[model samples]
Target: MHELTTVTDSAAAQLQQVRDLVALLDDAQYVRRPPGASSVAGHVRHCVDHYAALLAGAERGTVDYDRRERGGALETDRTLALARLDVVRSRVRALAPGVLDRPVEVSGIVDARGTVARSRSTVGRELLFVAHHAVHHLALMMPVVRTLGVSVPADLGYAPATMAFLRQRDGGTPA
Candidate 1:
């Protein structure tokens, strides 16, 4: 929390959070399904895909969120998931501060009817978004982990803004 001053820093922290969460699970638990809920691997893969897309977009100047790695090993293989998480963390941390402000185009489907929406953004903005988006999926996975008998750390998967507010309210991250 002390070092998350830049968008890239925040993105790295989010990926680290994913690493922390994944470290708690075995391969079985990573892909284990809780009745009526998505597997932890599924959620993790979804988040990872967005992060990957964000990085890819930064290079291409266009980010397509819908271009996901669905059914990839990231969803079922713990080692592969861990490797990608590490790569993403390293990549985000390596982003130049100037890259944050660079303009980029973005597109994604907005509805089940397959309508695509387009917009403009900066690499920093999209990084922040995917980080926050990962936290959202993390929140959903928390209960799944619990149901699977894993102990979740208190601060894992919390949104950055919420953590900031928590620091102000309690003078530190929530216990």
Candidate 2:
């Protein structure tokens, strides 16, 4: 239960960071697209969508990443995105003790060949996957944030391993 709570809390923390970042941006900046880059809201929506799918799967025993709600108000409105974040955070915090260990089926396209695949997983495993997935998308948004002149935390999008390595290199205690 502790491990499951930790995993979910980590994801919630990342979402909070995103909410904080969104609060700092104006509506135009939130939705602004830099030349060839995705908007900050787009990146945020992508991350939130994964969490939504994962949480929904927790109730159904199956997760499908391909079927996501896209281009809704959450993709363009910072306030709406923040509201959705709160909802996701609440759901994560309320996860049942045995929920994480339950077996689950994950289905999605696996390659450019248009092949679909299904794999057995667990709620805890999928939580970890979404945590990493959020980090990946946040890292991708770093440049967009910079381009928009918005300041972000130094460790905003760093993976747990990466954060540990950085701490070690700096002669600090490993996270």
**TM-score of each candidate structure, all chains considered together:** 0.92, 0.91
Q: In candidate 2, residue 71 scores what lDDT?
A: 86
Q: Write down the TM-score for model 1.
A: 0.92
Stretches of model 2 off by over 4 angstroms after superposition: 112-114, 171-175
Please list the residue runs of candidate 1 whose C-alpha ends up more than 4 Å from where it truly belongs after superposition. 1-5, 172-175
Superposed by TM-score, candidate 2 places the C-alpha of residue 72 at a distance from the truth, in angstroms, of 1.5
Model 2 agreement with the true structure over 33-111: per-residue lDDT tens digits: 9999999899889888899899889899999988898888888788888888889878877877589898999999999
Error of 1 at 132 (Å): 0.6
